[model samples]
Target: MSPTGERVAMATDELQATLPPAVTVYERSVYSDGDSTFALVNDADGKRRLYVAGPAIADFDGGTVQGDGQVFPLTYGNAMALAEVFPWLEPTTAGRQSAFGFGDRIGLATPGHVRAVRDSDLVPVFAQQSIREMDRTGRSPEDVLATAIFGVFQEGYEGGFVADADHLMAREDVERTAGVGFTMFTCDPSEHVVADADSMSEEKVEAAFAQIEDSEAILDRYAGETFEAKTDGFTWSDSFSEIELKRAAVKYYEAIEFAEELYGWVAQAVDGDFDFEVSVDETETPTTHLEHALIASELDRRGVEVTSLAPRFVGSLEKGIDYIGDLNEFEADLKGHVAIAETYGPYRLSLHSGSDKFSIYPFFEEYASDYQHVKTAGTSYLEAIRVVAENDPDLYREIHAFALERFDEDKATYHVNTDLSNVPDIDDLTDDEFPKILDQDDGRQLLHITYGSVLSATDENGEFRFKDDLLGTLREYEDDHYAFLEEHLGHHVDLLTGEIED
Candidate 1:
């Protein structure tokens, strides 16, 4: 922020005098050069234009420049770039508060999400996608944020939205996503979570801990030590056996180290303010009550300030389905988890596989004031598939067949239990009845997990088999798809906000 010149700041009268007589100045920002400012003005005909008010004016000359300082296009694609120049246009973290992350897997679900979110108190994370998904869909984080910017402009939504670099797992990906203008990073540490660490024997846990170079350092810090942490209403004071301490450390120490590395990198890598969401919800076993406190307390001790934490709750929160576990048990576990979070920091209690888990929304509503973040990505994609099934039978049938063919392979990474036999055979149904497959839980789960394979599937000829056709068909029936998303996603929002009718 060095001074480019000795030019004095303009007064309001001087600024008005410099503008066109008939134009209205909406915004003005000091250019990278301190002597000049750029104004976002509306012309007499109501078209938005960028007006440069400066003495140094050789570069612009009413044409686009190719170098560092260029005239931005009026296209929606430039919204993100414009936001960079004007900080007001950029969205920041919504803080440790109640928020909903509506991830649009196809990049077409934002407008519907916007419609659903505009009426509620919950903040909208309209541009939410994981690094895994970006790889799956051949998209970069920039594409995800750009698409959301356009969606916001289309619907005249200026309330602002989150550009979440969701489920990020590596250090290099952290630099890449932050450079692409994401305001939130969900660091997923599931890769380092040992399978069934809660059930490991003391010998096994010690052996696992023996692999760490400084295992003794961790043991000296927490082993045989009583942890006494409290909030106004809750307190957790417990001592762990050396084995129990090593077990928690073994399960999460590597993950926490990775998170620490990524957090420090991203905090300095990006230009603006951002938030961190730590996710340990990808492990095999359910996250134990003590495990939740262990991770959070250790994170605090390591100087990592978490913005949100996703626990592996007691349930099968499978894809495109309701919570498949005891609600009472979930509520009990959730209350304890929330208490742990409160005792440490009032960070968000984030739900990871939170799409269409209708039965659990009541819990979110119950703890609305306590701050919760529920993430949903595949449900919108599911609804879009529903649209395709109803609009174009042939394409839907082709995808159905393709999904079944790729189900087992694609489902390897996800936590779903869709028995292929449970899905009704398409051959047994008429074209008119095939779309109803979306209603069946098994069928929805089958299609849900196979999206990556289906999207990237190509034939022997080395060309896209169904990707182009699917997008084209979806585009043709975009309105139907949007309406469908609104009804489906709106109900989800309603369940969380208590706006649902009988």
Candidate 2:
């Protein structure tokens, strides 16, 4: 046998001899970097640890194992070390494909994401979070990436995965997540998107437009010029008149400039190529075709290659619920956006706040095809709560009651219309009926947007009030947790990968 095989054999023998009797090795996880062998093992109590053997064991991070070889606890440093040997642990670009990003606010949802994507056509972005989520949950970029690495390893998923620095609004956000090896930089330029431009008076629009550098050159390029675009089954044309050009420029010029600068920062921070997703989906006004064309063309002119762009589609795509709007209008609007994408760079059109927008997935598959990316952040946390609701009803009840009190304050940042009265009172629901609340709009949004408070809330003595119980219960009932995630996230993957109707 070859020397590498010999090393793997020797490591396997050592792992079998040294590991505690109670620890069951994840058989498929055994891998070798030609010098050392690594595997994931689950203890009798269900805790996971890494088993490494051979001379290279000293180079990897983690504590020593019992009988032979070294065992590393799943940690940020160890995850980094392991990635050096198995490069799949590191994030990579998903390119222009039908991809889905599963955001794990609490960092334990990747295993289920892996299972859901294993047999699907879409690429899986396992480590995805925003700066707001990090601040609220007190989780760093490293924590997000590290937890995903460990979960990916535990499940023996080696098909490859992408990591997204989702909703990055500033240079600092890009730098922080880039330092931790995130490969997808989703630049959120909504702050610079002038939403009032839609209703601004001609004088106001002109003022804002004049403030932009090289306004005349921009106007000369776009004003009175017709641009044609097409997608699979749709063709469209858009032109901006003098006043319309000024409005479009005022609405998105700053945002385009911000993305250009942020793109440079991303290029500087990331050592190699990274997926760049420009997001203006958080704005109040919908992004018209003319606006999208301007943003895409300007970014292209600036030499910024966007892997995907998330426009603020017409209608309401609120958090944690099915879409609420006229589907026909949304489809028409989506066709225009897809046409714009095809005309420019043929990039993916991402859907932000797309946790449970079930009614619209078919439209995306039909219009965007492979040029699409759906991001779902907070839904996994909701599924985790579902596990808690199913297993620990008392804990779920306590969390529900607290969520009610915190909903008004926490709902400030999220774009949700959850009327408190719509949610059934905790006392009115029996223990067996507790899990049913997750299916309701108000109850789901109430629990969905209040995750940060639920995870970080403390008692009067300054100790944690719900964090420990919430996590501990989830950990104890991990199988159920993965099951729920698999069911919910799997449904998403299935819907997005269905056959496109003719």
Cα-based lDDT for every prediction = 0.75, 0.85
Best by TM-score: 2
Model 1 lDDT tens row, 131-225:
88988977777778766765654454556777788988777888887886788998887777776667888888878889988798887777777
Best by lDDT: 2
Return the lDDT, model 2, position 109: 82
Tens digits of per-residue lDDT, candidate 2, 1-502, equal 2222322443445566667787767665677766667787776566677877787788766566645666778888889987877776777888887799999988778888888788888889999999888888989999999999988877767667899998888888899999989999999888888888999999998888898888999977887888889866788986888999899888888889899999999999989989999999888878889888888988999999999999999999999999999999999999899999988998999999888888899888878867999999888999999989999998898898899889889888878778878888778878989988999998899999899999889999998889888888887887898888998888887777773321
List pairs with backbone clashes in candidate 1: none
TM-scores for every predicted model:
0.82, 0.94
